[model samples]
Target: MINSIKTPNRLVNEKSPYLLQHAYNPVDWWPWCEEAFAEARQENKPIFLSIGYSTCHWCHVMGRESFEDQGVAGILNRSFVSVKVDREERPDVDAVYMAICQALTGQGGWPLTLLLDTKKRPFYAATYLPKNSRYGMTGLTELLLKVSELWKTSRNRLLESGEQIVEAMREQDRTGYVQEPEKNLLYEAFSAFAHSYDSRFGGFGEAPKFPAAHNLLFLLRYAKEENPAASEMVLHTLDGMYRGGLFDHIGGGFSRYSSDEKWLVPHFEKTLYDNALLVMAYLDAYTQTKEPLYRHIVRKTLDYASRELTAPEGGFYCGQDADSDGEEGKYYLFIRQEILDILGENRGRRFCEWFGITEQGNFEGKNILNLVENANYREINPTMEHCCEKLLCYRARRTFLHKDDKCLTSWNALMITAYVKAYLILEENQYLDTAQKAERFLEEKLSRDDKLFVRWREGVSAGYGKLEDYAFVVWAELMLYQAIFDIRYLKKAVRFADTMCDRFFDDTEGGFYLYARDDERLILRPKETYDGAMPSGNSIAAYVLGKLFKITGEEKWRERSQKQLRYLAGSSGRYPAGHGFAMQAFMDALNPSQELIALSPEQEDLRKLRKLVAAKPNLTVVVKSPENGQELAELSPYTKEYPVTAGHPQFYLCSGNSCAASVDTLQALKW
Candidate 1:
């Protein structure tokens, strides 16, 4: 007799670390594949789909409690075809089911569990079920049995419900088709955020606070001479987060989010997307306020990423796990004595007192090392940088944390933009060089036949590129061109933008889909416009489209961008906090970006010109050496006829079809 049982199942060959984590589960888990669906049909069983990332703590907890239990595995194997999906790897699938889960339960998160019919329509959805019922929660076993009974007794009703849910989702997505946001939309968004701003804490809302860095960026732009409150909100939030335990005082990167409203305790997971966006936010804060602290945070966060998250091959990794030694926050937390021992008694005691580290501890009798009380690092210890080196060295000797080494295209592109921003603001060539190297890695390793791929690990790349990947890559390219005056990067941005429209744009609908039409695995393609932990792909696409139109003066790009803004404008303007990224894009459309064309051969003069233009909000400045005029003219056709005014460098401020008179000196170059 042939053996029908496989202990490791099919996930053993999967590239995703989250999927591989369950490869040895007692439950026979198949990856989200056609074979899994086929097996469900063959067995006449409901499909159990679980989606999460490698770094999710609840995902680990659920795996340990239910997936590892032989009894639960037996029940699962006998009645349901269980399939696991890494949400990070297959976000298109996750988004569709997550929308259902949120609609049914009114909230959604990781370790998402759903029961689907053989046709792959979901009838039930949930997040993080415990093994045994407690705290008024339903246990996995009871839920499994209940689902099985329902499937058996009311098969037709269950199928109908699943069909209805899918159709409802499709209908909901199709309903919003508006043209252009109202004139007062941006003002309404600012007002909504102002009303919700946590004055004492610096962020918006209550416990489980996220950074919401994009919102801060939007506020920074909104804070003009008329709206000073916008800048105050941005500054307060930046100060609060940096002073909290959410930021690693020693290692110099931010955690995923704060578990508490005060930003004292964090979830402990560190993500590339968070740090990248945070760096951009901090940079914006620095530019607006000229605050040294914001600049320091940007440097520290980027340094941490370069040291810890970056691969030897030049690509940035996905994230670091929350748990170490199978315990949450073990690697991050330090005992009072441990800190004392790490540094000598005098230095350690001083460090502890300065950082609010004590024997009582803020988190489970272990210090999280925050500056909540004494927010000023320089005031507490002028030699804080030296002190951090000691703590970082000591922490390095502890139990090693798990780092998710996969280089995601969207995330890497975001990091590249962060570095470019840092360079533009701080005038740091090293930051610019780092950005260029990462971009080269993306192009050389992640691109095949001139098309970008999404995931890359250990020199291998797989998965079709998503809208985020295309949008962010275009964004990075545009920033790179602005920083280096490279025509090649500009051309590349245009090419990718064209490709993005071809692959992800919905012809009937104005917005871009998360997945391509040809991507057959997804049950329904999702068009996400809301800015979550990261900006939505559609939001970035709209923003990038606006910028492209400004740089290339393409009316078609502007038209497409306007269409997207119009489609999303009503909802975004109504809830600006929810659609911060889209609102930023809409704002850009209303005021076409200003471009400063400086024909400067001298490096010093070019730097000065860059500094002058960088002060302006939402401006795209191009600085070109006279030697590269021919190629630059070819790339940006409008710049072709305009000759260098004198042997000395000259600057022209261009807005739409008009260009101001050329100025030989930076002082005369008026905004």
Candidate 2:
């Protein structure tokens, strides 16, 4: 008989929710640390490393199937120094091993299973092994026994293979790739996206459509440069997603991705990054087309984040799980009778018809809400909002999915950027306030020695900041400065930019490394450039440097940004869809928007100019009172002689160290 008693492992004392979830497993799991490595070395055992986050469905499945099983646990405990790592906490570790896994197997994903030597170099890698051999794949128990035999017999070959893999990755990193950051790069990206564009269903590729939001941002910028097709693709995808089941009609945010091309079904997991990136995309769409639908989407997404994913301490949580009560999408799906019970017969039937809710449900015998069938639901029922509120209230009483409440610096930065952008476009003070609160929380809780850390939870912060953390937070600070015209924020941006250079920048090579040079645990420091689910550190760093150059008028900033762009140009041109943010950064570097400074103590023109800047979409406007001219002069020396004329605010269009004559009327302002 299987043992019913729970055995607490080393993970019981760990802080990560993912690790804590595995604390009661029969397998003696160790948290990723020097102590774990030391034990592996002392015992002369191979380290079995498992990397995943708390919200991952497959991670949970693997835990239940293999980790919780007594037989599988016995094999692992006897043969390997099993270690559990939360990918979100140590993304640097994940990046290095994931690259190795991809190299070994030509693909990689979580829950990442790797067999490493005592020195932490991976010798074997795979993802999600079952308890027993099934579906023509190796089982965890069998794999463990085989690995144990190999360790006893072929240990030399295994160590040699690990050494060779590490060397090859290092050699690959040393490759000096450079290309021109020209307008043609943007054209190439647009061409690639156009070729992959799904004319019928919207979005790129086949079934399993991911919301690669940076691609939309790139296309939106591309459309302005005389590419109407790009804009059409973006708008179609946005509208398709808005009407599809991938969007929570009851809740406010998007799931991680749609499982099918039609977006009728989703993976059911909601990540803070996806929602945050979607908000930016919708805001960009609203800016371009002034579409009310885009505006509504932005509002709904932000509201969902605020209501569900936000923490009590003003920081945002990581994500929500796909499964609830051991059933996938249970909390979200509804039966036809349930809709009738909640909304009554007349309205319920109409709601059912509109959302494609039938007795024969779209997913697992229950309807997942969607507007795919009745696209004109709003026209059919004007009281749709009230009905939705009623359904939402009822649904709230159900068992909610597990949420990952760890507030990450990089993820929080992305959300904060979205909030700042929302405030800029919508002119909502609450958005601005929310953005400021998150930034303040990050600053106070996740920072030490004037540097930001990776994860914060339950008043404890650990892990040094990665390159993305510094780059994204700098982007956030710049956005905050643009919205509020706070010199302190701008100065902080410059400070973090400097710190990023010191910590992550590759002096000999051009791109930034994913981890700090001083981080000793990493076998090989990976220099990542391709934008995956989120923008890469190199991409955001180049973007940040380009904006910093424009803001500070520093030649060093321009030179560094150009160098970084040159390093990224090859990937940006060759695989445009993969490097969407990098392409956008390249475009920004090529033709940066002119900086507009509205020098006035008067509130009216400054507000008008700020709104105009928002509407214009390409200009970065800075507003300051003439009374604080000395402060502006100290912060930015170029604005020293500029003054408010005749007690009325004046607008100066400045580009590349030259400012035009001050203009009073908005019509006289030059682009």
Candidate 3:
């Protein structure tokens, strides 16, 4: 119930889509800044901090139910200094505060609500709240009044509680000791995943299943080295996800996650990171098992990204919202009569049978359009493809879906790597071209003075880069170097890695911090290791460092990667399943890995050798031609002694610190 004549708030000046959505609310919302804290201190009032992203559905619900209400706004304006933050733009702030919420409430999610003192230490934390009390939940207005009363009457106690929480967090951060991970940690991680896996449904555990693509990537690596049975779980889960509503079969991208164990109903928000990581998972599946379905899924997912999420400047956008026209899932849902009218009688009936679009729908009396009911869903035909294309076009004209158009550096880097992987595995030059274009986009727009920024939108870049930005951009460069055997990309990766180490790496401790040393200081600096929907910054840092060490034979890279692995081992040993990406990095460190250096003048020979190495997941390859040999020698000094040949490529294969003699042909190498 906003005022009839609404005055714009401080959020009107911000660029975040989430912040802009609340620009006209009756509640005076201040974007996160020093001025908000100064106002809170001057007024001697607690701060109400709300953190969420634009595409989050519950955030929208909370906005309508509480933030727009006149009564709730009055209490928030009079008694507390209200602040709004888009978590995507300020993940450093979100990470530190989210740890507090999870510690206090035993769970955490978006529309994150916290009552904090002027010092910015949180005392009270919760998720979504209604304006009026309902369903046994506390009303936002009542909660505000109670907290205001406590601030006046029991001020000292509240301050002391906040101080204690901050101290406890500091203490927890100081508890870990650096130690090399045990050799059996990989087996332990595999056992954890195996125990929780749902044999029938394919995903792990119960309802509300996220894609968790990093876990599947780890399993693929583990299946290659140790247990072959690990692959069954990966294959089953991949097929199950594609067949269910979690994947948009017609539209060609995946939703956020499945709301049920059957994977039939999804949350319906499409994100760039989820699709990027899933593409890598599917590409690896295709490489290891040679499955056509996995390759098809990869192509479809990448095509979807190219069509929808990509910006005109070549960088990928953050995500698409779940709601359309003020209703969740409205853009995706369809009734039987609408489909029949759109496709006509025979083709419509066939499409309905194949995609589970029935008279009685599976969700809210409308079809979600899944292939869970079809036995031959993987077998594609021309008729099915044409009908889906027609339906997709019709759906686009029928509803308005909101897209978050901000380009995040870390997510765009992840997508770049996905495109590179697709190019390598599928031999599509367009994929490589797309990746190179995104790299140029990030370099031109997001990078300034050799340091990356967090986001860029509408020609304005803001916020300093975090660990994920540096780490993933380095990863993208490494992938680019591997795809094309370019010296410039390798040099660029090394330069960024040096900058990353200088800015975020903890020399005294082990892992990298979420934010840089010069970034704004929060209540407590956090170093995260858990791999959730996406891999953590430390995990990717460890992984790319390990790859660089293998490629360059640099002791500094090896030492840093080992230190990070030790830190991750200490943090993740108790619950190894939660740190999938960290374990994957550790596995790379522990396994018998090969480095194949191809010395030749012919580009065709180098290409064949690159494909051979790409097929083997554990092998790292570098190309040394007469033209680039001197440059390669400067980066990888070991390549200096290897002689370049004229007609065919001479391969120098090194496995676990031992080198075999150079071979003339692929048959002679006996790989």
Number of the top-ranking candidate, with lDDT as the measure? 3
Which stretches of candidate 3 lie above 4 Å from their native place?
1-5, 645-648
Off by over 4 Å in 1: 1-7, 375-380, 623-630, 644-648
For residue 658, model 1's alpha carbon misses the true position, in angstroms, by: 2.4
Per-residue lDDT tens digits for candidate 1, residues 226-307, read: 3777998888889889899999988999999999888989999999999999999999888887888888899899999999
Q: Candidate 2: where is the Cα deviation over 4 Å?
A: 1-5, 377-382, 644-646
Ranking by TM-score: 3, 2, 1
lDDT of each: 0.85, 0.86, 0.90
lDDT of 2 by residue, 375-414 (tens): 5733524477678888889988989889999999999999
| Backbone clashes, candidate 3 | 0
Regarding TM-score, does 2 or 3 come out ahead?
Answer: 3
Taking every candidate in turn, the Cα RMSD to the unseen true structure, in Å, is: 2.8, 2.1, 1.6
